[model samples]
Target: MILHTTEVTPLSGYRLLLRFNNGAAGEVDLSNELDGEVFEPLRDPVLFATASQHPVMRTAAWSNGADLAPEFLLDLMRVQQGDRAA
Candidate 1:
Protein backbone atom coordinates (compact mmCIF):
# COMPACT_ATOMS: atom_id res chain seq x y z
CA MET A 1 0.00 0.00 0.00
CA ILE A 2 1.14 3.53 -0.66
CA LEU A 3 1.82 5.75 2.37
CA HIS A 4 1.63 9.43 3.07
CA THR A 5 3.13 11.77 5.60
CA THR A 6 0.76 12.90 8.33
CA GLU A 7 3.06 15.06 10.34
CA VAL A 8 6.60 16.42 10.42
CA THR A 9 8.65 17.87 13.25
CA PRO A 10 12.07 19.30 12.67
CA LEU A 11 14.76 18.13 14.99
CA SER A 12 18.24 19.40 15.63
CA GLY A 13 20.94 19.34 12.98
CA TYR A 14 18.83 18.92 9.88
CA ARG A 15 16.86 15.98 11.20
CA LEU A 16 13.11 15.48 11.17
CA LEU A 17 10.62 13.37 13.08
CA LEU A 18 8.05 12.22 10.59
CA ARG A 19 4.81 10.39 11.18
CA PHE A 20 3.13 8.57 8.35
CA ASN A 21 -0.40 7.50 7.53
CA ASN A 22 0.31 3.86 8.39
CA GLY A 23 1.27 4.68 11.97
CA ALA A 24 4.97 4.43 11.15
CA ALA A 25 7.28 7.20 12.34
CA GLY A 26 10.99 7.92 12.79
CA GLU A 27 13.77 10.44 12.88
CA VAL A 28 15.42 11.20 9.56
CA ASP A 29 18.82 12.92 9.39
CA LEU A 30 19.17 14.98 6.26
CA SER A 31 22.41 16.77 7.02
CA ASN A 32 24.18 15.08 4.16
CA GLU A 33 21.38 15.60 1.68
CA LEU A 34 21.68 19.39 1.82
CA ASP A 35 24.24 19.89 -0.90
CA GLY A 36 22.66 21.31 -4.05
CA GLU A 37 21.25 24.79 -4.64
CA VAL A 38 17.70 23.96 -3.68
CA PHE A 39 18.79 22.05 -0.62
CA GLU A 40 21.46 24.50 0.38
CA PRO A 41 19.04 26.82 2.16
CA LEU A 42 17.97 23.93 4.33
CA ARG A 43 21.49 23.49 5.66
CA ASP A 44 20.70 26.16 8.20
CA PRO A 45 19.05 24.57 11.21
CA VAL A 46 16.53 27.42 11.39
CA LEU A 47 15.58 27.09 7.76
CA PHE A 48 15.42 23.33 8.00
CA ALA A 49 13.06 23.62 10.91
CA THR A 50 10.52 25.20 8.62
CA ALA A 51 9.57 21.79 7.30
CA SER A 52 5.89 21.08 7.01
CA GLN A 53 3.69 18.49 5.38
CA HIS A 54 2.47 19.44 1.96
CA PRO A 55 -1.26 19.40 1.23
CA VAL A 56 -0.72 16.51 -1.18
CA MET A 57 0.26 14.30 1.78
CA ARG A 58 3.09 12.52 0.03
CA THR A 59 5.95 14.33 1.75
CA ALA A 60 7.33 17.17 3.81
CA ALA A 61 9.20 20.20 2.59
CA TRP A 62 10.86 23.36 3.82
CA SER A 63 10.00 26.92 2.87
CA ASN A 64 12.88 26.90 0.40
CA GLY A 65 11.31 23.94 -1.45
CA ALA A 66 13.54 21.12 -0.26
CA ASP A 67 11.39 18.10 0.34
CA LEU A 68 11.65 14.39 1.04
CA ALA A 69 9.47 11.64 -0.41
CA PRO A 70 7.50 9.71 2.20
CA GLU A 71 8.45 6.41 0.59
CA PHE A 72 12.13 7.25 0.90
CA LEU A 73 11.63 8.28 4.51
CA LEU A 74 9.89 4.98 5.24
CA ASP A 75 12.70 3.04 3.63
CA LEU A 76 15.21 4.80 5.81
CA MET A 77 13.21 3.87 8.88
CA ARG A 78 13.09 0.27 7.75
CA VAL A 79 16.82 0.13 7.24
CA GLN A 80 17.58 1.77 10.56
CA GLN A 81 15.38 -0.68 12.42
CA GLY A 82 16.49 -3.68 10.36
CA ASP A 83 12.95 -4.31 9.27
CA ARG A 84 12.30 -4.99 5.64
CA ALA A 85 9.86 -2.79 3.81
CA ALA A 86 6.61 -4.43 2.90
Candidate 2:
Protein backbone atom coordinates (compact mmCIF):
# COMPACT_ATOMS: atom_id res chain seq x y z
CA MET A 1 0.00 0.00 0.00
CA ILE A 2 1.21 3.46 -0.89
CA LEU A 3 1.31 5.90 1.97
CA HIS A 4 0.90 9.62 1.60
CA THR A 5 1.39 12.25 4.26
CA THR A 6 -1.66 14.32 5.01
CA GLU A 7 -0.24 16.79 7.51
CA VAL A 8 2.97 17.83 9.14
CA THR A 9 3.68 20.06 12.12
CA PRO A 10 7.18 20.95 13.13
CA LEU A 11 8.07 20.73 16.78
CA SER A 12 11.02 21.62 18.96
CA GLY A 13 14.23 19.60 18.91
CA TYR A 14 13.76 18.98 15.19
CA ARG A 15 10.79 16.73 15.68
CA LEU A 16 7.61 16.66 13.62
CA LEU A 17 4.05 15.54 14.22
CA LEU A 18 2.94 13.76 11.06
CA ARG A 19 -0.34 12.33 9.88
CA PHE A 20 -0.53 9.80 7.10
CA ASN A 21 -3.20 8.73 4.63
CA ASN A 22 -3.46 5.43 6.42
CA GLY A 23 -4.72 7.18 9.55
CA ALA A 24 -1.45 6.78 11.39
CA ALA A 25 0.05 9.71 13.25
CA GLY A 26 3.12 10.19 15.37
CA GLU A 27 6.09 12.36 16.17
CA VAL A 28 9.40 11.71 14.51
CA ASP A 29 12.66 13.34 15.59
CA LEU A 30 15.02 14.24 12.80
CA SER A 31 17.86 15.83 14.74
CA ASN A 32 20.30 13.12 13.73
CA GLU A 33 19.17 12.92 10.11
CA LEU A 34 20.19 16.42 9.06
CA ASP A 35 23.54 15.57 7.57
CA GLY A 36 23.92 16.16 3.79
CA GLU A 37 23.48 19.38 1.88
CA VAL A 38 19.77 19.02 1.23
CA PHE A 39 18.95 18.21 4.81
CA GLU A 40 21.67 20.35 6.40
CA PRO A 41 19.75 23.59 5.85
CA LEU A 42 16.98 22.19 8.00
CA ARG A 43 19.32 22.39 10.99
CA ASP A 44 18.17 25.99 11.30
CA PRO A 45 15.15 26.05 13.57
CA VAL A 46 13.42 28.59 11.36
CA LEU A 47 13.87 26.51 8.27
CA PHE A 48 12.97 23.36 10.11
CA ALA A 49 9.76 25.01 11.19
CA THR A 50 8.97 25.58 7.56
CA ALA A 51 8.10 21.91 7.23
CA SER A 52 4.75 21.29 5.62
CA GLN A 53 2.92 18.85 3.40
CA HIS A 54 4.08 19.28 -0.13
CA PRO A 55 1.16 20.07 -2.43
CA VAL A 56 2.24 17.69 -5.15
CA MET A 57 4.42 15.24 -3.30
CA ARG A 58 2.00 14.84 -0.44
CA THR A 59 4.96 14.50 1.87
CA ALA A 60 6.84 16.69 4.30
CA ALA A 61 8.85 19.41 2.64
CA TRP A 62 10.71 22.61 3.45
CA SER A 63 11.22 25.83 1.55
CA ASN A 64 14.71 24.63 0.71
CA GLY A 65 13.26 21.97 -1.62
CA ALA A 66 14.07 19.19 0.78
CA ASP A 67 11.40 16.55 0.94
CA LEU A 68 11.15 13.10 2.49
CA ALA A 69 9.14 10.24 1.08
CA PRO A 70 5.95 9.39 2.92
CA GLU A 71 6.98 5.76 3.12
CA PHE A 72 10.25 6.75 4.75
CA LEU A 73 8.50 9.04 7.17
CA LEU A 74 6.02 6.35 8.10
CA ASP A 75 8.82 3.90 8.70
CA LEU A 76 10.61 6.41 10.86
CA MET A 77 7.47 7.08 12.82
CA ARG A 78 6.93 3.39 13.37
CA VAL A 79 10.49 2.97 14.52
CA GLN A 80 10.17 5.85 16.96
CA GLN A 81 7.00 4.27 18.27
CA GLY A 82 8.98 1.05 18.85
CA ASP A 83 7.25 -0.85 16.06
CA ARG A 84 10.20 -2.99 15.09
CA ALA A 85 8.31 -4.55 12.22
CA ALA A 86 8.51 -1.32 10.30
Give the number of the best model, judged by TM-score: 2
lDDT on C-alpha atoms for all candidate structures: 0.80, 0.90
Q: Please provide TM-scores, in order, for all candidate models, with all chains considered together.
A: 0.83, 0.93
Tens-place lDDT per residue, model 1, 10-81, is: 889788888888988778777777888888888777898899888875688888877878988888767766
Best by lDDT: 2
The residue-by-residue lDDT of candidate 2 on 1-86, one tens digit each, is 67898889999999999998888888999998899989999999999999999999899999999999988888888888897322
Q: Show where candidate 2 strays beyond 4 Å.
A: 84-86
C-alpha-based local distance difference test score of model 2: 0.90
Q: How does residue 42 of candidate 1 score in lDDT?
A: 85
Worst 10 residues of 2 by lDDT: 77-86
Off by over 4 Å in 1: 84-86
| TM-score of model 2 vs. true structure | 0.93
Task: Point out the worst 10-residue segment of candidate 1 by lDDT.
Answer: 77-86
